[model samples]
Target: MIELSTVYFGLLGIALITYATRLSGLIVMDFFPLTKRMERALDAMTGSVFVAFVVPAFYKGDIGVKLATAAALIVMFTTKKILLALTAGVLTAVIARAVLG
Candidate 1:
């Protein structure tokens, strides 16, 4: 039989290991030389990660939430107006909640 204390310590150890592994790259990255290709790759990686997080939030979300967010993204992309896009998205969400709920 596994002791509760042992199980807790085991889980904690796993979490620490995972965190250390993820952070190791960031910690060591500065040690390396930055080439033009590496720089471009890093820039693209930022946008890719942003899209990865945002797309699922829009597509898999509730209809109202998705539509509102999509509208915001479209506006932000076309006009590059951050404030207007944010206001439109928030208003859409508020209206949707008021009407739907």
Candidate 2:
């Protein structure tokens, strides 16, 4: 079995590499002017990336998680407040887990 410290260090390495790549992107972008097309693509890319990260887990998560995501989505749509949506999601998850389990 893998050691706990090894897994911890592996995660730290992954995080550092992720940060480095994002930082490099920012650094490189400074040298180039973003055209309208590029700006549009970047804006679309953000939503695509969000869906990529969320869709799979949303597909496979437990009932509590699904309900939490729904609650969050509703709150976000109605309030346009990220913090409140996140709070609703958390509270929904807690209540759903307790009730469902």
Which candidate leads the pack in lDDT? Answer: 2
lDDT tens per residue, model 2, 1-101: 89999999999999999999888767877798778898899889989999998999899999888999999999999999999999999999999999995
TM-score of every model? 0.62, 0.75
Model 2 Cα RMSD, 1 decimal: 2.5
lDDT of 2: 0.94
lDDT of 1 by residue, 1-101 (tens): 99999999999999999999788768877897678898899889989999999888778788678868977888899989999998888888888878885
RMSD of each: 6.2, 2.5
**Ten contiguous residues with the weakest lDDT in model 1:** 58-67
**Clash count, predicted structure 2:** 0
Clashes (backbone N, CA, C under 3 Å), per candidate, total 0, 0
Error of 2 at 61 (Å): 0.2
